[model samples]
Target: MEIRHFRYFLAVAKHRNFSRAAAQLGIAPPTLTRQIQDMESDLGTRLFLRLQREVSLTDAGRALQAEAELTVRQFEAAQLNAQRAGRGETGHIELGYVASAVFSGVLQKQVSSFRLRYPDIGFTISENLMPVLPGLIEEGRLDVGYIRSPMHLPEALSTISLLVEGFALALPGSSWLCRLKEINAAHLQNEIFILPEQISGTLQVAAQGGYAPTLGPQPGGLVAVVALVSLGQGVAVVPESMVDHIKLPNVVYRRIQDCQPSSFLSLVYRRFEKAPAVARFIEHVKDFSERPTL
Candidate 1:
């Protein structure tokens, strides 16, 4: 009839004596007997054969015993899973990121470390262009995202800067500018700019050089943009870390001199994300961002 009734019935069945079972359950023997009697009445079947001072199970009782044990175990397991979810130790998160985040290696390091710390927490990550990432977070399709700074974020979303970096000039290896020790903004005045669709920092730096440079079609990321540059399409200014992941034999990275453009990554998420797992991940990232060498 109820969970307590099943428990009482099992206790009586285990000890084979109402008095001993009641003592084990910390309840009065009469109370235990009444509860069992109520269960038998609800099921419309006699569960036990009561002798002078002993009890034995009936055929129906044996069947109920097996089902009851499994049910109780399953119920306990469900409770434990719920508790784990509440603590943010077990759940799912959908993370979105720009391709440049991988270039820095900090994103991968933080994710791997978080996995080691919270193995039960599950998540999937997707690489998206900066323009689409904020929309994904706002629409609830993505729990969080990493994007370039100075985005026109939605009112419902918030962001935190992960790291600040400087820009590097990506040029064709055969280009004459590669011969320079450090490139100054003045040097880029005559160069064609191969820009990623979301590269506002690069655009700004190029503008400061007094060049209303010709803009190429929006290449998706630094990798693609660099590939275009390697073809002698145009020069690209990208995050300094892009050199780490997009190393091409025909492409060379040069530090920007005289005019150092600010480059940084930011984490974006809904201001009121309901998932405990997302909160845990955000907190973990905050701790990672505060590290000295990140």
Candidate 2:
């Protein structure tokens, strides 16, 4: 009837003697005998035949024994799986990122290292614009996020700076900005600064460098912004890491000289998270950030 009944049946079947079976079960022989009798009464079938010195299994007893063994094994396996999931050893983790995170290469390296360490954990990654990533994390659409700074983070979200990098101007290959060896805010005074439709961290960087840059059309994302820059539509300042993502031959990235404003790559997650996997991932990111980099 209950799992204990199956256990009693198995112990008796294994030992064959009531006294020995009860001893293995840490119970008295009389207790074991009564339990077996109760199980048989509940099942409406005799499970064992009592011989002169030992007990032998009847046909029904053998069948029930086989089924009980499998059932117990499966139940134990289920319990173990639940525990592992609770411990964050096995579960799904969704990670969202801005384009700069990928360009920085830290996000990819951190993910690879985490996967190697926690192979049982499942992961999914999404590349989103800076403005949406924090909301995605807060709304539970993403477990964690990576984004560039000048972020207006909600109270529910927490962040850690992974790296600090300077901004670089993405220029048209034939533009005069590319010809200047050392660029300053003065050089960009008359330039049209292409900005993404979403939140622009570069605006803060430009502000810090004392430039009231002329605004260009707001494109969809950094990729499109750079594409527009390649067409000589305008120039754009982005984190240095993002230059790696700019593959357009028509665009050249130049570092700002004299007064370049720096930007930070930060990892963001929800506060008071209940998922152990999310906590583990946050810890991994922190640890990765602490290590020395060349």
Candidate 3:
């Protein structure tokens, strides 16, 4: 008839006395009797045999008892899970990122800190191109993204700048420029530039050098661009953090003396995020960014 009826039946079954069950349930004995009677009437079967001193379960009552107990426990568990999800204590988040975010270590630090605080929250992490990350978040395919800054994003998406880093030149170790005590933008005027996902750093270097860069292969990720430079295909301008993280053979990193172009590693997500776990992650990143040590 109702969940309360099942509860009343359980209490009575446990005590084998209406007076004791009513006391445990904090209801009048007559009310508990009527509730049990309602359940029997709804099911078209007598669930208990009432004796002068105590009550005993019928064959139908024994079967119903097991099912009712399971149903009540499942219902209570469902309610608990829903409350935890609403509080951002447990849920799954789909995260996307570019290679530079991992190279900078900002992604790992923030994720590790958040995981320590909310261990029940799960993650599905993926690596994606810079331009594709924002679109994935906007399309609801991804909950959050870590990407480089100075790029266009969909109107529905927003970003928080996490790390600001300068660019470095990845050149062939045997190249003649490596012999120079200090290299500057002016010296790379005629050199071919291997392009990564973002070309702003290279363009900035060329602008300062007073020459239009000879743009070379449009290879995609940071590692691939560095791989091309290792083979002497062309030099690349990449985030300075890559100097420590990427150690491809035959590729050497040099700072451009005359120009320092900055690249930002940012966290991107929907402007109006609905998932509590994703929103909590965004807040955690914001807190991490504002710390003085960062």
Candidate 4:
């Protein structure tokens, strides 16, 4: 009839005596007897054969015993899982990111730390363009995103700046500029610049050179932009961290002597996040950022 009824039946079945079962259940023998009688009436079957000293299970009681044990175990397991989810100990997070986030190592460091703290929380990570990450988070398709800043964001999303670094020039290995001991903005005045999703760094470099850059095709990701440079299609200005992580054939990274434009790797999430797992991750990011050292 009810979960408690199943539990009472199980205890009585285990001990084979109503008095002992009642003692184990912290209830009087008469109350336990009445509850078992009520269960038998509801089921319309006699579950036990009562003798002068002890009780023995009927055919129906044996049939119900296994099912009752399974039900009680499953019910208790469900309650435990619910409590863990409420505490942000077990759930899944949908995470999106740009290529630079991985290049900077901020994503790996922060995620690894969070995993160590909440091992039961799972993650589904994906890489997306910078422009779409905010939209994904806003639309509830993604729980959080790692992206580069200096771009427009939706009103419903908020970002936490995680790492700040300058830009570097990605050039064809055979370019004459690579031969220069120190390349300045003036030397890149007439070069065609392959643009990545975030163009602010390239624009900043051109603005400092006192001339408009010869803008080229805008690619989707950093790897594609660097690949174009490897083929001698054009040069690119990318996050300084890329110099260390993105090593493609025929593409050389050079520091610009004249201008130092900053790029930010940030974590973006919904302003009002409802999922406890996602909220816990955002809090972990905030805590990781405030630490004196990573």
* TM-score of every candidate relative to the true structure: 0.92, 0.92, 0.94, 0.93
Q: For candidate 4, give the lDDT of residue 256.
A: 96
Give me the runs in candidate 4 sitting further than 4 Å from their true place.
Answer: none
Off by over 4 Å in 1: 292-294
What is the Cα-based lDDT of residue 167 in candidate 1?
78
Q: Could you tell me which residue pairs clash in candidate 1?
A: none
Error of 2 at 153 (Å): 1.1
For candidate 1, write residues 51-152 as lDDT tens digits. Answer: 999999999999899999888788889989999999898999999999888888767988899999999998898899888889989999999998888769
Q: Which candidate is the best by TM-score?
A: 3
| Candidate 4 lDDT tens digits, 135-216 | 9899999999998997789999898988888999999999999999999998999899999998999999999998999999
lDDT of 2 by residue, 63-119 (tens): 988899998888889989999889888888999988878888889999999999989
Which 10 successive residues of model 1 have the least lDDT summed? 197-206
lDDT of 4 at 161: 89
Q: Whose lDDT is higher: candidate 2's or candidate 4's?
A: 4
How many Å off is the CA of 194 in candidate 3?
A: 0.9
Return whichever of 2 and 3 wins on TM-score: 3
Ranking by TM-score: 3, 4, 1, 2
